[model samples]
Target: MDRSKYTILVADDEELLRWSIKEIVSRKGYRVVVAANGREALEVYHRDHPDLSLLDIQMPELTGMEVLKQIMAEEPQALVVMISAYGQVERAVAACRLGAQDFVCKPFDNDDLLRRIERILEPVRLRHQVEGLLADQRQRYAIDQIVGQSESLREVFTLIRKVAATPNTTVLITGESGTGKDLVAKVIHHQSARAEQPMVEINCAAIPEHLLESELFGHEKGSFTGAGERKLGLVERANGGTLFLDEVGDMALDLQAKLLRLLENRTIRRVGGVDDLGVDLRVIAATNRDLSKRVEEGAFRADLYYRLNVLPIRLPALRERHGDAPLLVRFFLDRLNREMGKQVRTIGEDALACLSAYAWPGNVRELKNVIERAHILADGERIEVSDLPAEVRGGGAGGAPAGVATATAFGLPEQGIDLEEVERRLLTDALARTQGNQTQAAALLRLGRDALRYRMKKFGMLE
Candidate 1:
């Protein structure tokens, strides 16, 4: 019969305990490596590169905590369960503090041990499945360009597919400024039947209210003083495609009525032309404002809001997408490296930690800008904490003056803290827990190995 394959490492001073763990794990369709001392454990760990480890806390030549530290330094996400005696609970807690995934007493029950292992491995397995799907979507539809591996982004991807395929739907995408609302609109349009046709985008807030109507509906020559010839409006151009109205909440109240009419009747009259032109278009609108509040205050039209909000997609802010920061950072790093002709290959773990913990109110667009700035400032192939923008490295002192309340509300790090140092501590702890395995470290950090490495060097962890 075929069996699932997993590799495990067992390190203990006593041969009996080592053998016990080895036997237990091996019986579960895993290949096992046994080490009698800390030095041997490190050697086996490096040589075997096991998927999981069972480490004894007390060992000759090196303490389990010391071994754990070294393992974490190398592979921040390595899955290692620590073993300690009942009296040595302090050591077990210390191991946890240092980043051990789990701990068990020396007189451990085999079933309980198996259960702990299962709990740790289950998420890893599920994460892998999710990553596999993301990778496939990236290749199949260029979805990877969006650049996030977080569960939140996965849900977003799922929702995009569902909402985009629905015919004749009006989708209102709401998010803070620079959260990639336009990109989401494009992805939806690309996935829909309108892929072959044009996707016309209009920024309602940017355009003057007087000119908006003329832009939406084509104007005939002599209709306006400056009108030179008969021109097709965006609504007419997007007849068989999609029209993305950005900052829809900012549109003038009167124009909202016209938009509502067009959505309901699927027809438009040019600014000066009398004939009504029939259209078959899909509307996908986005706004940074709270339309509901606007409606209550009479700042926005309620009927128009209802018409555009048949489907709503709210994007998660960068802070809410907890584990995606590092992934996106790596992507930006690679992109900047190529564009700038720089060989910057790594970021210190601490620097990455800074980015992960900091609340990016500006979201993905801000992250990209920060990375580009860091790339330009980097003096070597690696990006250092120093390379980060002064605003970020200064712990929000120089940047926009959003107070601690804002940070607390959005789950950002405290203002004026050493972001790089905080990142370093988090990365160090995660690595120590995982026992120096890069792949596991990535999983713990919710990043890819390349991302982890880039950050590791940026924080001055590299030789």
Candidate 2:
């Protein structure tokens, strides 16, 4: 809207027409640069880097179409409007195809010309605004946001740095449901060459099987009963960027084959379309499911597994990264304070110890949620143990009764007992209490099912 900051370049073979256009636009407070031909237009464009250009279809030294092509080659995003006589409308349309923003006829009114210019500049202005917002987000979600000082987390940070620098390596991120797999995928994309482009995401397990294919590979109009218009699939939209497939292990076998084909050939055909369209994008697939076990069970394709496992990055569960809970608690507390408009600056040491001692079934996401809840409930400047969740404060499975001596259920001896034997007994008791349901047992133990399974296997309790 501030025209004084923008400059316009006007190029035409007729000196009178060039001066007339410059005078009309300059009256609106924009600085005007005049050129007699296409060659001079390019010279002025390269020198001044004007925001917009108006060129006549007929010019000396170089034709307007030739100049448009050269300008686009130099600056793909440059805004240019072509001018033509009534008979040269066809040529003007050709200029539009070569990246001209819009065109005005020779008999065009000054008001009409200015309106067209404003319309063209509006989109450019909005795009720049969106780019600024995205830049801020890129900074916020940088790899440093994956907070932890433990060796396991440090190793994950190292792997992310190494893989993010690569251009097209397919990355498979394996972790528990809430272990920040999505965050890892985003960091890789924002750090890659395709950061400027959109990173399209499709949750393979979230959508129904019947619609998932159509969503991934768009359909043409009339391709299906309800499809009324042609659709661009996520693969096509992510052509120059990255496509993140979350919960990919739950994808159907038939869809897995098609996805494998896309990975192998970099081409996809819509469900009812005949033509195969080529797409170039980096693929990052994530899942909490044990894909290798699924393959062994014939539920998942082995070939597809191998393709996706090329650059596997397995995230460590929260419990595996010991001593990191207090760090995460502080980080979340500080963030929640600002977000929730609370004055709670620090957490009591007893509350911090309770949080660190409890097994986090839902990982960092759950920790953040707990901190937010506590921030809202805290009546004083610091979070106390009373502000924590009942399960955490009570230190029992789903907040067992205070009178129940769950910690001493096995009745430890005066002498120290075997830690592994005690853990094995606890795991067995949790399983028995849950009627052999691993999910419920994991909940009772406040552990992720994957973590619980690992311990079960270690104790020879898994069949």
Candidate 3:
């Protein structure tokens, strides 16, 4: 409400009316500028760029409608208020449709005009506040803000940078749970040209199947039970921005078809609505599941998978990103030090070794959680071996990660090994590696799919 920070432009052919308007607004502490006609109004507009413009409907050189059109074309969000005479109300309504934010009548009361301006600028103030918050978020989740330096992580960073430069390509981020897929999505959005706009996210797995279509495409009044009014969906809300679909592999089969149509046509029909609403959307789809495997299993649609996979980014598991544990540990410790008000300066070598050796099945999130627990449990100024959990202390001694025993460690019996059990173990390992995709498992075992399936059936492994 600091009126001094806001400037108003008063454009009228009548010099006396312009001066009177300036006096009225300037008395309220607003910085006021005046213009004699439509042509001069544009000059002042392009030059000073006032926060608001009050234009008279009838003006010399150019009509108010003409000025409105040019201004809107140049700056669509420009705040404009048309001044209309008694007979010019129709023109004022037309001006509203032409992108003027609001319209006021000639001989309008000084107080009423101020009130109208106040109401209009209030929403603008809210929007500015939202934009300021987004600025802070952009700094926090900036592209390079991800904390890691391993070679595998470097590749992901390179892809994120390349993908962010694209204007609006569909992006598919694949990674295990807790591997920061969602964070990568946010980083890409905030680093792109659409940073100033929104990045709306929805977890496809979390929403019920019955309501997901309604949530994504909205519904008209009386479209369904409890449908009382027309509603805009998430796609409409994110029309000018990004829509992040997390766990997209879990989306229902029926919805997958609708989503495919949306991607192909760039339009969506609200449930029970007759017309298709066009949308400009940058879809960033993410999944912890292996979508190729899902497609092979017929649980996910192949065409939709291909559409979403336009620009793919696969995040490596923490254990796969060799030499990153130390860096991540240091980063998390620094943050924990400030957060917990603890002064643990350094971790013992024994503790760091255990962290690096243990297979991070839960990935980076697990590491962060472990670090937090250590910060709380460390007795002295530094973290020692005793501060670590038992699993970390006993893991990774023989080059194999925790909980995974080597074949040599599971040594062949002195008498003899059971050939049947060995075959069963190999079959299970191959299936696990390929997430139950028969063709892929076959390739891994260097056997045909028929042979693999026959063996799996013999062992009661096939459903």
Candidate 4:
């Protein structure tokens, strides 16, 4: 490590001890700041903000314990080590309780003192690194990271902004699988008052019912078979932050009741623990299932349903937001290009049209997957229709007409024909045979009248 970046503070009333510490630490390439008394220590601390501090217990103006308390109150993360004589071991213990990192004895071996300081500073270095990583992750999940231009998606963004400003409001996001429900939950948490705190997530459906209770509420040591030590549950871990209960509809009825209690009381009891520990957190629950319908069917609790439905935000399915497909395609394309180190820039018109027309049953997630796959398989600078998945190219449910094989009456050609043009001509021919009779034309085309009318409108053959 480059010790030159670190600054250590040494505060001692004894000049000899203070000089000794400063000499030893400064030789390690660290900048050293010295203070002759506790009061001077606090003054230097506020001004310099050194990475670590070493203080003698028996000081002039203020004692080390008092100085430690003041430092902790001002800068909670400040690293301080107490220096005490052999007769002052009890006072050093007191200093540790007051947030001192570690203590060193007077007439202390220089090597032992140096080792203790290194141990304390090691965790501080690690914590800074971890915080940096977490900050980067939070940026990735920011509210603006969600991509879509459709009006329905805009409305969802409006709701997210409104709900996020209210730190304690419980959010219930309902949507189909792959519609970015989990992303929405994270956006809410990261943009809320508890953004600096941790956000704990649990997939209710992913965990087996037998072990879910212990997972949510935690289990005490020896609470069950093979329970070796106490474990903090997701609820306790999420205290003062956000708890995202994903696929909550799949949670068992018994566990649902326990969760309802926790929501109502803002307290949770571990599996085998007798005490009820209070928790302060916002609950954001998500599910693809129709919870109201489940309540009517007696599978879900009506009371819990009402409680969670307070700030309901329903996400529009990808098919419902057809206008967003092209934008989402470009978004994922750019992301995959950067990630996979591909030069695929723009998409071919045919590929773009195919993507816009397809009914993405899996929603935005499936679209992202398709884009990634295309980026990987693409041999040119642009993605072509042939680069897409067969289902997408066929456009069976997505919006295009059935594949060219459906036009086999004229035998298969070496090159495939446009399915939309073929379907349009077929519709016109059917209508012509029926003299423009709507019902008769539908029967000739082997399609329902409504289906025929929709096709007519889509092909611009309708007046």
Candidate 5:
């Protein structure tokens, strides 16, 4: 709606026509730059760099066709419209072949010219908007936003920078849940050459086993009972981009084989289709599970594990990073202030000490959640010790543990506690929450039913 920035170039031999076009365009708040001849038109073009140009076909010194050709050669993206008399249809065709966008005959209507100019500039406006949004996104996820100063974190940052420069090298990130594995994947992708393309993400543990295959590999319209139409798989949709497999350790064995084939052969076959389609992309997988352990247990394939581990990156849990608590706290506080529309600007030393003392079982994720909770609880500009959860005070009696996780993850207190006792309690809690449904409880605990049963049987709690 703001037309002030749009500049139009009106080049014509006839004085009246040139002034007419200029007056009509300038009234719409667009800046108008005019040239009396073709020779001067190219000069004005080089000087002003107009958004759109209207040229007279018959001009002294050079023809409109010559000017259009030279401009197209230098700037193929330039928008140009040629002006010709009624009998100059062949010349208009030639102008188009020379890269003119459109042509208007001599004695063109003022309103028609204005409308055409408006239509042509719509694409220019859209291009500007897309560029601006991508710029903001790049700034938002820049490597500096990680917010840490620890040596371990410094090492992780260095690895990220190195691996991001290499395209098509499969990367596997291993760390406890909430260790910012997902964030690191994004940083690698957005920093790489594939940033402009789509970065498709799927959680192998999130989707149900039966449908996940169809979701990843797509399906023909009649592939299965519920499939209504032909669907492009996530893998195909992500061609020339990235497919980030979060919790890839949980993917089915059959799908894992297919994925391995994709990595090796760069081709995918749809669920019920016969033809193999070649795909080009990068795979970045993240998991909280110890894949090597899983490989030993036969739950994951050894060959596939080796393939994915080509460029492995392990993100350390927040507890392992020394003295990053305060920095992370401040980072979340500043961001949460803007999001929650509150002025809780600072955290008292007492509260920060509590955060430091607590084992961040959930790592950076739990810390972020706690900061938001504190921001909501605080009535003043500062978050005091009392604003923190009791577990953060190391009370360990109420609410879920700050970093309380499944069988794979546990928050060990500074003073040692019985590990088996904690596991027994968590199993009981999950079972009770899911109303004694073993499968649902297993999912809630991020464990498979068999794994849950093994723990339950070990404790003689199997009913």
Candidate 6:
């Protein structure tokens, strides 16, 4: 926006000519620095790193051609316009071959000079803007190198673009454990309008029933026993940003009423505080639970359910996303080798078959852990079936065979089958593995803690 702030370096041997050029460009809202010779121009160029450079062809120590070559070598895309006297047309032509943008003859019209400079700089300015935009986009979508080439991931990409454009809407993401729901939430927050603000997450089932309320809506000083000082709740701290409720279904019935009130009123009253404080935040709630079933069973509040389910997004389970298993396994293997400083390369055909054949009950998280375990214990570049955990390698009651049968047996199937029964078993297994740690269970299951709770209710398997 500040055109005058853009720096330009003018290099010419004649002091009068340099002064004239500097004055002309400076008047047109550009900062100008003058150098008496090419040697001095290179020094000033290094010091200032000016946006554009104007070099006189003939100089004392270093000729304009020499400076142009050095500058181009340093930055292949350096923007430099060569200047020559009336009879040095041949020299100017030679400068162009050496990466000079355009040649300006001596005693040239100032208007033509200005027009030429603008013409030369326009493309650079456009490229810089485009690159900045692309960098921002990459930062927004990237999630720790969780690469994907499947149609399922492509659909997720489309959903991300749509959701990012409307940051304020409440999003409900449903998926089996290990399906990357948290990763999706992070991508949405990173790309949203409130990216600069904080993203506060609360595990609804992690906190005790009595403490969950205070965790969400802070207690006032002296409001409760041992409430020594005033505290800000997760919702209040996430003001003007995003609040990710990971296990909303685990929230006590009393707290659910309060949460609904806050979502509706957009305000909170800290414990013992009288006045309500307003907040502006986007709510992204995830659960492995079936909210509709919970509502039907009179478990979760219907009003709150509808309020949170503004835009629904269901992530595909790993087993359902055909052909992505091998890609994921390789990605995890590469990550494992880099972190552990190993040279492990390929998964043996037997190992690859076993991986592809086994149901990834743990989802991506389980898959990653399995690969890490294998890489650490593997004897060579290729991991054999022996490297895998016994349960996964055996492919039996310990672990179901790969694909639909295994996914169903592990209760990871999201739809088409007995969806409720599948989710119920899945959440139950995740909870058992984590030893009732809803947070860890959610991580293992790749569902939000809240999502796991919903699934529990749908299957009547609440912990």
Best by TM-score: 5
For model 5, what is the alpha-carbon lDDT of residue 365? 94
* Model 1 vs. true fold: TM: 0.56
The lDDT for every candidate, in the order shown, is 0.81, 0.87, 0.87, 0.86, 0.87, 0.82
- TM-score of predicted structure 4: 0.70
Candidate 5, superposed: residue stretches over 4 Å from native: 396-463
Candidate 2 lands at a TM-score of 0.70
Q: Write the per-residue lDDT of candidate 4 for residues 1-463, one digit (tens) a residue.
A: 6678778999999898889889998998888999999999999998999999998898999988889999999888789998899999998998888888788887889888778777888877787777777788678888779888776788899999999999898889998899999999998988888987889999999999999999999999999999999999999999999999999998899998999998899999998899999999999999999898899999999999988998999987776664678888888888887887878989998888887766677889989899989998899899988788888887533335343234335665679778788789989888899889775576555454667888999988888
Q: What C-alpha lDDT, on a 0 to 100 scale, does residue 300 get in candidate 1?
A: 92
Alpha-carbon RMSD, candidate 2: 7.2
TM-score of each: 0.56, 0.70, 0.66, 0.70, 0.83, 0.59
Model 6 superposed RMSD (Cα): 14.6
Residue-wise C-alpha lDDT for candidate 1, range 299-396, written one tens digit per residue? 89888999998988888667656578888888888877788788889898767766765556687999899889888888888777777765565454
lDDT tens digits by residue: candidate 2, 374-448: 888899899988888887776543454333346756766889799998789989999999889786687667665
Instruction: Indicate whether candidate 1 or candidate 2 has the larger TM-score.
Output: 2
Model 3 scores a TM of 0.66
Candidate 2: stretches off by over 4 Å: 1-120, 395-407, 412-463
How many backbone collisions does model 2 have?
Answer: 0
Clashes of each: 28, 0, 0, 2, 2, 15
lDDT of 6 by residue, 1-463 (tens): 3457478899999989999999999999888988888889999999999888999989989998899999999988888999999899998998898888899999999999999888887876787776676567558556545467776677877887799789889898887778888888888887788786789998887888898888888989999999999999999899999999986766777778888888899988888889898999999998888788789988899999999888988787775566788988888877787888998999888778777766577788888888888898888888988888876776443454444343434544455477666567777787888778776676565454556666777677663
Clash pairs for candidate 3: none
